[model samples]
Target: MHLYFLMIFFAALPAWFLSTLEGWITVDCTRAAVSSPMECTVGERFAFSSRNTRYATWKARSASLHRHDRRGSSVSYQLVLSTASGEVPVLRSSTGSDKIERIARDLNAAIGAGSTRFSAEAPPDSLFWFASFLVFLFAGVGALIALVGKRSGKS
Candidate 1:
């Protein structure tokens, strides 16, 4: 019975989790749209705040993660950026003139996509599914065992 429960938890718990979770990723590429002081690096994760108001809190407004590539210049940069309160954080967009143009074109495309900015959210907890599965499995097994014992006149 417990084994059955464990299997159920392993299988059914993920469904509950999938239903409950809203999957979203923050991908900020431009800084000028941000309202807060922005922090950035190539291979590092940093916090980006909006410049909306120094004291007043501004919720995470938008974010974008994108790569700008230039064919002739051999220049490309991957950027993740966000903005709030209308501050647009700027990222390095070019190695030279052509690169700049390429970057601009890419940004323009992002704008046309109608989702130029993104909202930042915490990383998804993968273990959420595991935990939920375990909970369901254990509870189901325990309940089944209890039911069987009750029918057999065993407390």
Candidate 2:
């Protein structure tokens, strides 16, 4: 039974990763020339506003793109804005590194700042690695339990 459950869990991982690609955020700089800051709006592609829609504004001079390395050659990118409080992520993506990099370059050009790429190494305890460890741990324990149970039944 546990083996069957493990199979199901493994099959669901791809579906979960794909589901994350559904939403997008748009950064608008048209108003920047009028002394207005750039704005990032989420859920614009869906043409409907829900509670999940997010609105953020920041001066272009203070924002840049950040790329974070993930497990298995995967990369996560985000548009980060530095403010008095701290850096805030206005947009994010786990795929499409080229497209995201292009957008970041264009935005940086508009801001009059050179486009910069910041790559952060993945932490040892990243979610993906941790989850993978847990899965293997459980599988090993389950296999041991089953093996013991079978041996005892044969006695």
- The estimated TM-scores of all candidates read 0.28, 0.39
- Model 1 has an lDDT value of 0.37
Model 1, residue 57: what's the lDDT? 20
Instruction: Provide backbone clash counts, one per model.
Output: 25, 0
Per-residue lDDT for 40-72 in model 1, tens only?
222212222221211112222223334555643
Candidate 2 residue lDDT tens string, 1-155: 75555544654554354334423444444333434444443322211222133333343222323455554454555555543455565543343333445555556565454212221111211443444555556656666766677688899
lDDT winner: 2
Best by TM-score: 2
Which pairs clash in model 2?
Answer: none
Worst 10 residues of 1 by lDDT: 48-57
> How well does model 2 score by local distance difference test?
0.43
